[model samples]
Target: MSDVVKPAVPPPATPARALLPLVLPALVIGLGSSLLLAAVSEAAELFKDVLWETLPDAIGIGRWSVGWIMAVLTATGIAVGLVVWKAPGHAGPDPATTGLVDAPLSPRVVPGLLLATGLALAGGVSLGPENPITAANIALAYWLGRRLVPGSSGQVWAALGAAGTVGALFGTPVAAALILTESLAAAPRPQNPAERTPSLWDQLFAPLVAAGAGGVTSKLLGVPSFGLSLPAFDGPRWPDLLAALLVAPVAAVLGLAAVYAFPYVHRAFRMLPHPVLALTLGGVVLGLLGALGGHLTLFKGLDEIGELAADPKGHSAGALVMMTVVKLAAVLVACGSGFRGGRIFPSVFAGAAFGLAVHALVPAVEPSVAVTCGVLGLLLAVTRQGWLSLFTAAVIAPGIGLLPLLCLALLPAWLLVTGRPQMQLDESGAALR
Candidate 1:
């Protein structure tokens, strides 16, 4: 008989003793990273605003029509291409695929991603800079953790970095925790022991530190925390709750349709001769939508929130419906044609428009409250982030105590939509082909 060898026993963890050593360092690194990210975001936003104010007139001297937009797109494309070519680590993958999870960037690549995203957003691309900001934050955090605590494993640093980054971006520790848990659930596992698993406790610790730092920095910098302080609605009425409940299934179906349609749209666009050609076609489609909606549907929809809120009833119901459809088409085309951006803002726009339409039909409910509930319900249904959806809706129309009604609307929609397969390809972009 052959001799049998016994399996080697692994060393045991030090239980509570080991936790203390990690706690302080993790907080230091997380908080530091969060503060740095806030500074970076403020600077980027200011610069973009300045560019938008000055660049259009300067570029418009020679040509009257489409000159500024064309110039912006070309410049943005070149900047993005350079970043992708030279600093692949900086170019965050499509946010739809990765959701809100953070991944570390090499220090060298952070600048490139930041610049690329800033230019793209400032240039009128239908995208937001948050994804790139989050990417850079995590990367910097990882680099700092590695430098300060040489003994820690790369995986530990990565988890810390992700938690910190999410906290900074969302401005809420609980939301960050939820994002981490969802991301960890979604991440695929490797067959080997060397591969790491992200733990729930690990997700909580760093995000908590980062959120504290972010809140402090946001207050100091005069940046909004994206939190809502809505006015109290007369105690939640059953009729309003029932109406919101009725809307849930509609939103859920729309979200499911979007996910299912995304891949096919993307594949169709990829058949173009080149990325530039694909994007130009996308621009044409967007321009047509803009013609129909009077330029409101063209960009990332950040500035339009105020317009949407202020003039919910000023425009005819037909205009709101037209804007909704055009904006949705523009988003689909933009994402399908290889434009790099996040869908969060666009989803907000779409949801808001949809809510406005719904309000037109049902006259009893307050328009603001109806829009708020609709936006939250649809965003949660599509993105599967109930907390983020709640916060976003509340912030958009603060002073309308609609959270309970919003939650009532959202929870069912989320249940209907969750566990459906995601539409975007994996980070490597392999699955899309």
Candidate 2:
């Protein structure tokens, strides 16, 4: 399944003249999208500091105190609820119903989505900024591109925008490329013989340009690398493969459990009278879990997971398990209740913690091997994208030596998750395809 086979008939070469028009537009979309992502992220960080730091100091309460954590989360839920209830476009559909790249939303929906996203991120809602940011950028790009370049297609701008946002989010173009490849491969080929089907590279060329620009802009802004700091593995061994097989499947199972529960959770939340009530109650549950699991289990899990990777041994097996379970539940609640964020970041964090816990218990599995396999499985189950799952795992635990092992280990997890319900939902609130 991983191998690439060439088509029987080659595609007609794309003219440089035809590509020139896209070059300028792709560059603009990439740069503008990155700036939008960065600005919103910084704004959220500012609010986060005030909510978790300055306010706590002013009130003379522990930042991690149960009451304080609950208060802030509940308040955030109310604020976001108001936005969803009153803001234009209702924040652009239930977040649980959306994927990383969907149809571009109305531009009117962007502000509310960004506001809700900012609140969710600031309040340690255990979600990341990917989905909403992508949606906002796509909307903005499509809206402006149609005006600025009258001949450009909406699909063109949407693709460029999605690619750019993905590149910025991951701090690399390869992730965008891999993700877009999966999407492009799913597209139906033209049936007419006279109308040549484009090769994968041709399909990806414009998006890649946009992704590169976004990635370079993000790097220039000094975002930290996505790779985690794990103890290096010496080499792949039979035992390590066995360890990966053991760890990856278990992590994938945990992720699938959440995927299975997603709709049920969303249904439960919808039973409430209002979005405000549902989200506020959801926030309370998250706060209780946070207090139980500690702050390590809060937020989107990127920085927290990095802290764990930096010193995997510092946490006990029990603590790691608590963190993983709490994070899984938090993601379900945060997203199910209509919080604007993505699951990938939280899932990555959960998988890493689970991997470290396995190491703590077994003591034989190498940290690098365990971490990568764990992440690979969880991402596979959560995102249901093969190349994406593999790429993310490799990025989190950077070691060329582990690539072959990861690829092989992915087979079992992929088999387990294939045909299962995805994390997203359809219009009727059932599991989306």
Candidate 3:
């Protein structure tokens, strides 16, 4: 959540009107950072296009092959490992150990980390673009802010930059605002009673401005939403509700299996003693999983999830189950071995696959409704953000009729997931590299 960084110079009890000036700076930083990262992301996709599509065509491989997939991922591991070894930032903080709101990193390390992340993304690594890009933007904001406003705390820029990135990535400031609320509200009161900390709204004001700007910028640039178009569900059937109540808990428990496995994998990867060896080995393992699960399990899985949603019944139940399992395993290996990315996208993919498989077995259940509930359970267990879990599920399967059923489903799922270890690392990172 939020770290309690006592501002060195106590912030004045400035009136609300006086705070309006900060919005301009926040907006500029937010838009600028998002634009910069957007370019980076586009380049990454192009690189991946060359590797996965263009290169394949040039080589005249009539179709995708397992051998080619294995070779690419393995080479990717070595390339990223080398960058980590020689790069200025050492790939920034170990992503496996870092939380969503990590301390700002030094500016010099941003480029190397950006390069490494691009390579990972292009290589079909089973990770999303959240972690490393946010880190890069934070550093960018801080470096620029120091020149523009030297007295301000670095935390301010870090928060705004992160909010901006989240907004841009999700195409909405709501996700960024909601996700950061816990951190903002949870900030511990300073030790000095005389010092008045800013109100939560005051703290959120700047971030919200940045998030709004970022969201607008992304929309203008035509970034798409993660919403899935499912079969028309006019009303929640009684059978669907019953099915959700039963299936949600199962999904929660299934996701927890990976949470339990994470730290162990983190520990094992750390034992390798070198980034080169650790990541290379991880990449090779991911290649094998890709071979097993096929192309659907590769990358961050956003596009692939859409593919499955577009044709839910195209694959058999067993195949869907294998997609979930192999993708989960790939997420663990990629994260544990130091490939920087967020857990949200991959977890959503895994959740959808699990739901599709369950729906295949229980024909009485509606596919979209079941998928939403399954996303609810999986996100609850994985991210432990209750509001976000519900919000994400409903948004993905946006039908007013589905909300009540999803809310009921969350109750049983919450119980199953509550008090369990989350898919996050402790601040100490004793078990992490």
Candidate 4:
């Protein structure tokens, strides 16, 4: 034995048998994640109808009136603020600083997060269910998985939960697979020469299973798919490629502007003496924007995106542009003021509107191409998630014909967003530079 003792020979790569035992647990985690997500969403919808329709109608007020919009949103802000300030675990963390996925939160924090998320969703906050749902699922999975699989690490449960929730959210295992694959690929590898490195699929096996289970369960539960039933792309022409090139990078630039503004906006809200005041003020501002942007600009963008797609020409270009701007502003305020939610859905909504606006101004561009490319660019800039951005764009437009053009469209848009500040803030209370 020399002074530098060689490392002991490591075992061979993880065998398939070793992973077989995990299948059941992964399935359980996936189903649980989807169930939790569905429960929250359904509850939110019930509350949303009560707030936006039933109560308003009962009171004999126009549900879409500016006064009603402002009042409900303001009241919502106060309620969410109180929850964040006093509820156990304070709803986990500031929405402005968090990403779609993070380390698992404490079990004690889950209830408060659910309450906050439900309120935000019902109140028409311009954020999505992705973030809080993912966090809560991870926490629950970790807590329960420890009892289920005593030897498993927290990372295992976290990955399973993330995969499950993402699948449920997008209504497809592909999205979860892409996201987890990207994440696993970036993880550091073992350095020992004797250690046999596991293949990518080896690492992905359990999570993919979890994702699949979650996706199927969500479908069985009748969750709406993300695919908008748009007119098919009539194959890509040179002009269509040109339209994509022109549209994508422009949308990326718009999203980048919002990214750059995010930290400063969060800081402004932080200056308020209390969470309640900050959130209430944010609600007031959102109400004003909603009053201007109209009903199309309210809520997370899933239904609104479909509504916009259903009748692309119904709104004037000016109206579409206004909807896009006001939605972006509302997302900024809702997130920065400690509201618990994600930005993806709202950005998707805004992207659809912006794309339609471009089409309204220039009818020569194909609606399918314009809308998909618009979604691609904005998601690229805002999420900084290449696979997810591409996947979402393709899902919304649904055609193999558009795939090649989307790949090309993503190139310039990616370059524009690469190395820029992400929408998330770091520990120093500044956007990641």
Q: List the residue pairs that clash in candidate 3.
A: none
Estimate the TM-score of every prediction: 0.78, 0.97, 0.92, 0.96
* lDDT tens digits by residue: candidate 2, 217-308: 98898654467989887789889989988788888999999899999999999989898898888888888988988998888887898899
Whole-model Cα lDDT of every candidate shown, in order: 0.62, 0.89, 0.84, 0.90
Worst 10 residues of 4 by lDDT: 192-201
lDDT of 4 by residue, 401-427 (tens): 999999999999999999999999986
Best by lDDT: 4
Q: Model 1, range 177-201, lDDT digits (tens) per residue?
A: 6666666676677687775544557
What is the TM-score of candidate 3? 0.92
Ranking by lDDT: 4, 2, 3, 1
List runs of model 2 lying over 4 Å from the truth: 1-7
Cα-lDDT of candidate 3: 0.84
Best by TM-score: 2
lDDT for 191 in candidate 3 is: 94
Between candidates 1 and 2, the lDDT winner: 2
Q: How far off is residue 235 in model 1, in Å?
A: 2.5
